[model samples]
Target chain A: MHPLAAVRGVPRRTWLRWRFAYLVLLPTLILFTYLRVFPTAWAFVMSFFEWGLVKPAERFVGFDNYTTLLSDKNFTTALLNTTIFAFATTIFSVILAIALAAVLARVVRGRTGGLLELLYFAPVLVPMVPVTLGWREIFNYNHGVLNAFLGIFGITRVPWLSDPNMALVAVIILSVWKQVGYNMIILIVGMRAIPRVYEEAAAVDGASAWQRFRHVTMPLLAPVTLFVIVITTIASYNVFTQVYVLASDVQGAPGRLVPVIVYDLFQNGFRFFKMGYASAEAVYLFLIILVLTLIQFRFLRGSRA
Target chain B: MNLRRRGMSRVGYWILVAVLALGGIAMIFPIFWLFSVSFRPASEINTVPPNLLPVHWTLNNFTVVFQRAPMLSYLWNSFVFATISTIFIVLTSSTAGYIFAKFKFPGNNAIFMLVLATAIVPFEIYMVPLFLQMNALHLVNNPIGLFLPFLVLSYGIFFMRQNTMTSVPDEILDAARIDGMSETGVMIRMVPRLLAPAVSALAILAFIQAWTAFIWPLLILNDPKYFPMELGLSQFANTGSSNFGVTSAAAVIALLPSIIAFLLLRRRIVEGITITGLQG
Candidate 1:
């Protein structure tokens, strides 16, 4: 104590070291508090009040908004559509990605792997607006590429975006087109990481490649598969661009996913000045996502156990 | 044994190639068409027999887009905003990533978990209030308005943190401490080289996020003059009644920078995607 008391003044070096991390973290904390946490809290509070976009007054409406949303047929249909979109895309994409990645992992050598990956990943870089425009042209009934190609096989032209019966499928195709590459790359990496020793051991024991893969690789890749399923499902549920572009008219008028519902709310809330209803809708969509994510977490936990 | 294995492998290779070749064409044909239609005269875009390839390529469409829409202005706006936003993101996330990776600070685990938790919340949900906050701060319609919110990415932080935690060994930090390097000095000098992969990945992700940021900017910026490329492209699409050619051309212009950027940094982009997806 006597020796340390003699050196009363701490060095500038120690002073700077003490505050370095906080200096880095302080701005981030403030930013997140303002942008992320505040918005979420405001959205929640706003859900309980009837407010106008332009007006300052917010009347406490309590549970009426929730009741109204529950009775709204459009809301129910959007919820259903969101569920369908999420499950369908997740299943198809997971299966297709695993199959494609498994195949590519085997044969692609050196430079070809990079080229194939480049081609597959091109869509990720392509912005949503242009991608939607290209899809519109591709899905065009008369002069569209898909119809033109199908004509060679004598199949009748399909009204992809126009027909409500097929509109969901069209959106699904775009979602798959945009996302499958991403999922595939992930799976390919996962497949590559499976030690070659397992395959060689299986081969030595007279196991076929498919059997070896099913027993050894697939089981090992289960965590990756689970991760993809949950993330893709959530992403598909929240899909906005394709729906916003394709169903330009009557977007809120039943039979679209939840994000479309959110978009509709955006228009109504901001554009038409119905802020209360929009906040209510936002909360509803939040609950749906919350429940789905909770289910996914539980599923992952159960699988792990 | 050798012949059978060789034959099987060859057959597998060809089939994979055939399918992927087909799939690749199907994927890239849209991009090809976007370019083809962009250069063709307006009349040729959706003609009776739609042209697969423009007979006479011209800069006329680009010229029209530049004249009709503030395409160049919008592009400039996007470039400035994205560049600034990306720089901040890289700087802040890398530093925070370093802190979380190296130091055993108080509440670190809780903070990390909170950052990770925020990842599950859709970014779109924060738009309205963010707009309100920006308005209160008088940041609306400013480039800083566009740049600031995107600067702090939870995903980037989490990514950098994970990368650092795995690769930046404590022994290295100990050695630096022994050499009397301050923590900031050690981080600044050492982390960047070690964080090449994470930084590259985060940069691409940050660039893409800022570039495609539509709804947030649409809410915050009221002026058409301040619109990013995404909003500009949407404007072109929305005014579909009068100016299909210009709209399509504007779309073409919007496509250029992203595709070009991706081409230039394709490997980094792919690496970034694979890393994020693997961590999924």
Candidate 2:
């Protein structure tokens, strides 16, 4: 017998040592193959061809979809819109979260943590549809509370959702409002994990609140900050539900945002039975997201390193 | 503890509380508005002058919501899908988590790295391919379409591994094995009790993810019969009906399960996020 195989019961036979491990991993592998790998492979294959829902035969069109996407007007616009939405949401949500987290860390005592967390957490649990519908009501030009609030200061109705120019901004605000609480919770935990010793040390050196925050708190929160930024950005890029609900269609009057364009493509591809075009559009979106995600991961990795 | 900063700290804490309270209200105001609107009469919605409070409060909207569409059916669909997916996630992840934590196996690190790598890939790319795969298998518009793909959660496995490795001591596991417990027996009998909290936390996350899942279900489930509440809500909202009250009511119904679940499981949810955030 091999020296390694001399174990009495617990197998020194390395492979036999973990039948349970294989058993455990079996379902996960099967599920991933069916759900993730199979689809991902199929999509990759489909990307290389011109095919749709109804086409009798798929024409092999290598790189055509990729090249065409680069030139498509709607694709460009959607790209821009997606960028704007993601950038705006990420900046505002992160700032708001950091601000709220700082305050929550400093001011709230006792049950304050629980209370603030609960309140912020409410929006997360509330279904997106209701939240979007509520925003629609609030952004209703004539009777909307937002306009009503602005009217109090003798300001004119801002056409919150009506004007395409302001529509994107309105959508961004809704996204931030829905998400800020989540970021706050995460940020607060980050802030809390920074020990009291740092604050005490800073105070001993006569460092003011702003000084301590800038030097002590912010630096220690590097990981959480990166997490918040990456998640928010990725999520913003995938900002479909809010946009679909708020803006309704892709052609936002004279112009459309990237996701709206994607949705339009989807509508054309699937709804209108233009499968070939929709696949092209999906592939286009895939490439864009892929590039942006790569950039984000690279930047984050580079910064961290 | 410093006497000099005591008063300042107290004042600062109160100020922060007030600000956070206001912010929290701002965050939840839309939800409150949704609730109030749902209770109002049909005529009250889109009124000449909006009523913050309903003129004539009634449950008629709720009644009509059930009557107007297959609201109950949609609710059941969402509940079933969320439940099945969550259960599968918890069970598979826990087992995988146990093996990764307790057993020293070759390629463990490599396997974990592979699983974690998928986390960064935006799921949008996989969406269409997944649909096509389902179509190929004739699973389109099927409930299994929602549950099957979602079952293999890399994050769940990672989470379970992280939790078990940290929480389950090797001694207890070794003792279980010495006591004639099979490896599977050790996992089933011993590991679960130790990993209950992590399991619940994962369950909450899985539930929310599955419940709020929009795009996947939207793509796969074209049949109205399998329409989850979120999609159903959108369909109702877009029907161009003047009954905003009922629409709002249906929205509320759709949202209630998650809201209630979150409220019930807020502690677990908060702990899960905080723990994951800290560890990461």
Report the number of the highest-TM-score candidate. 2
What local lDDT does model 1 show for residue B134? 76
Per-candidate TM-score, chain A: 0.85, 0.85
CA displacement after TM-score superposition, residue A221 of candidate 2 (Å): 0.9
- Expressed as tens digits, the lDDT of each residue in A6-125 for candidate 2 is 653345545455555776787776776666666665666776777766562278878787687778776677778878888999899999889878866764545867787788767766
Off by over 4 Å in 1: A1-18, A250-259, A292-305, B1-12, B241-245
Please compute DockQ, using alpha carbons, for every candidate against the native two-chain complex: 0.48, 0.55
| Candidate 1 residue pairs that clash | none
Give the TM-scores of the predictions, in the order they appear: 0.89, 0.90
Query: What is the DockQ score of candidate 2, to 2 decimals?
Result: 0.55
Docking class of 1: acceptable
Q: Tell the DockQ for candidate 1.
A: 0.48
Q: Give the alpha-carbon lDDT of every model.
A: 0.74, 0.75
Residue B133, model 2: Cα distance from true site in angstroms: 1.2
Share of native interface contacts recovered by each model: 0.43, 0.61
